[model samples]
Target: MSRSATFDRQMLETAFSEIDAVHRSLPEATLSTLAAEVVTRVANNLRFAVQPDMVPCLDEIDMLCNALLSDDPHAATAFIENVQTKGSSYETLCLLYLTVAARRLGEWWDNDDVSFYRVTVAAGRIYAILRILRMERPIGVPDMQRAAAFASVPGENHTLGITIASDLARERGWDIDLFVGLTHDALVETLEQRQPALIGLSASGRRSMPALTRLIVALRISNPNARILVCGQIAAANLALVGLTGADAAAHDFQGAIGHMERLLDLPTGRLI
Candidate 1:
C-alpha cells in the first residue's frame, strides 16, 4: 500500500493492536520473530512516507537501528552523519523512535537483567514501531499544593523543552500551568496569583539570557519562597553561567528537572505522588 493510503488512524491502531497481542503471547521465539516482523512492516511503510527517492538511504535507518539496538558507537555516529546528509526529517524520525525505544528499554530492563545487546535489540524493534505510530500528549492531573508553571522569556522561540518539563512534572502529580510565549510581566502576575511552588523558565537562544535574568529577578522579588528552575539548550550549554543567576536549580533535561524538584520538595527520587 502507498504510505499515505496505509497511514489511516484505524489501520495504524489495528497494526498496533496486533503487535500488542503478539507481545502478550510471550513465547521467547515467537516474541523475537514478531519483533523482527514489526520492524519490517514499519520500514516498508516508511519507504512510502519518506519517498521512494529516500529508499536507497535504508543504510542510514539500519545504522540508527544498530546504534539504539546494538549500542554500536560507530553506527550511532554514522547514523547522525547520514541524517545530516539526508535532512531534518530523518533526524526527527530518529528522535521519535529513540523516545519510544528508550521507554521500552526501561520497561524491559526493569523486568530482568537482560544483556545490553538484548536491550538494544528490543529498543530497535520498538523504535521501528514508534516510527509508524502516532503519539498523543498525555493529559495531566492537577495537584493544588505543588503546582508548576512554564514560561519563556521575550524573544525566546523554543518551547518544546519547557513543555516536556511541565509534562514530566504533571505526570509526577504537580498541577502544571503551561504558559508559552508569555512576557515577563504576565508570568510574574500568574505566579503571584497561583502561588505555585516552582516556576520553570526555558530559553533556547543566547539573546534571551538578559530577559530571562530579568524575569528571575522579578519572580524572586515578588515571591521569595517560590523555587525557580531554568532549562533548555542555552541553559545546558552554560550551566555554570545560569547557576550564578540566583535560580534555585538548572536542569539539563526533563528527568534532571524532576529529580531536582523532588530533592527540593523532599519527595522520593522517582515518586512524587
Candidate 2:
C-alpha cells in the first residue's frame, strides 16, 4: 500500500502551488521535506473526506455483503443492480458499494467470521458483477495514466480475481493488458515491449512471495517507470510487501487498486466516474 495517497483535487492543486512558490524562492534546495509533508496531509484528507459518506451507504453495503456470500449467485447481482437502479451511478456502485462490500468480506475472513471458501466465492461474484458493468461504456483510447497490465505470480494459478480486477479497472476507463497466465520471462518480455504505466500482479500465498518479489525487481530494472501493485493474499502484509519486494503499493480490491494507480501517477481528478 502506498503510504501517501490523496484523492482531493483542491488539496493537490494547493500543494503544487506551494511547491511552485518554494521553487521560485529556493531553486537549489531539495524538496524531500516539503514533498513528504504535503503527501501525508493529502493522504489523511482522503480518510476524512470519504469516511462520513461511507456511513450513509453502510446498511445497503452490509446487506449486499451478505448477499455476496449467499448460495444463489443471482442474489448478489440482483441486490447490487437494485441499489444501482435506485439512482447510484455505475461509478459509485463500483467505487463505493462494491468496494465497501469487498473490504467487509476481507475483515470477516481476517476475524474468522467467514471461511475462505465462502469469501472467495463472494469475491468471485463481485468480479462477475464488474464484468457485466463493463459493457455499459464504450471503450476508448487509454489515457497515458490509465493503461495497465494484470498478471499473476509465475507459479500461481489463481487468476479469476485478477481477471475481474482488470475488468473493473476497464469499467473505470483503464486499458488493461492482461498477462495473467504467462511465465515469468514471457511476462517480463511483454511488459518490456508494451511499457504500460502500471502493473498489477496477484499472489495467493507466501509461496508466491519470492516469485512476486523477483518480478518486481525485474520490472524496476526493465520498466523503470512502471509502478507495481500486489493484490490478493500478499496484500495482507502490504507494508511489508512494499518494503521487502520493492512494490509501490498493494490492494485487496479493485477500487483500491485504481485509487493507488491515480495516486501513484498523480493523475488529474476529473474522471469518467
Candidate 3:
C-alpha cells in the first residue's frame, strides 16, 4: 500500500480503538467531554499539517458541542452561526453528539432508529480534512489531449465524495476541475466553455435530484458529446433514478466511478461531442 493509505488506515484504527477505550473507562458525561477534546486535538493536529485558519473554527465547534451535551442552550445557540458558516460538516458535527447520547442513554447500536449524529459529525470532520488537500486536479497528464475536467453540481454540498473521486482521477493523470457548488445556469455555461471529456456530479441527498436532472438535461442538450457521470450518497441510493435522469452512467463508489469513466472514455465510440 502507498504511504498515505497506510497512514490513513493506521490513524483511523487508532481513533476507533481510543473511542472504544474511552467508552469503557469513563462515565457517560466524561466520555462526551473526551470526545469533544479528541475532535479538537485531531483538528489541531490536522491543521498543523495544513491551514491554520481551520484550527480556531474547528475548536469552536468542539466547544459548542460540549455545551450542547451539557444542555447549555445559550452556548448552543451562540455557535449556530459558526456552525452554519462551516457548512454541512457542521451538521455532521451535531450528529456526533448522538453517539455520546447513545452510549450514555444505553441505546443499542443495532437499532435502525438509533441516531448516528456523532458518526455524521465525524464524517463531516473527515470531509473538512479532505477538502484542505484540494484532491481534484489531475496530476500527470502527458499532453493536452489527455486532459480532463471534473466538477460537481452547484448547490451540492457533498464535496467529500467528489474530492475522493477527484483524488483518484488525479493519481491516474487525468486533468480535473472540481466545482463545489454551481447553479444550473453556471454549470451549463461552464460546460459550454470547457467542453470537458468527462463531467462528474456529486449529490448527497434526494432534494438535489431535480436540479441534478435539469443540469444533466441541459448538458445533454448543449454538449451532447460530453460524458456525464453521477456519484455519491444520492446517486448510490437511487441509481435507477439517476441513470434514468439522462446521466450516461452512475458510479456507486468513488473508485468504481473512476474506473467506469476511464473505461467509457477509452472506447472507440466514446468520441467527444
lDDT of each: 0.53, 0.61, 0.49
Per-residue CA lDDT of model 2 for 88-133, tens digit only, reads 6544565556666766666676698976556545644554444334
Decreasing TM-score order of the candidates: 2, 1, 3
Candidate 1 per-residue lDDT over residues 1-273, each given as its tens digit: 211111234443443344344345444553443343333323332222444453434344444544655433334434444444444343244333343334344545556655543653553334323423222212133244556677776567787767777777777787778888766667767777786767778878566665665566456444545667887776667645333345778876777877767665555566554
Please identify model 1 stretches exceeding 4 Å from their true place: 1-146
Ranking according to lDDT, highest score first: 2, 1, 3
User: What are the clashing pairs of model 2?
Assistant: 1-250
Cα RMSD of predicted structure 3: 18.0
TM-score per model over all chains: 0.44, 0.47, 0.43
All candidates: CA RMSD (Å): 19.6, 20.1, 18.0
Model 3 Cα lDDT, one tens digit per residue, 190-246: 777887767787777777665665566456434545667887777667546432454
In candidate 1, where is summed lDDT lowest over 10 consecutive residues? 133-142
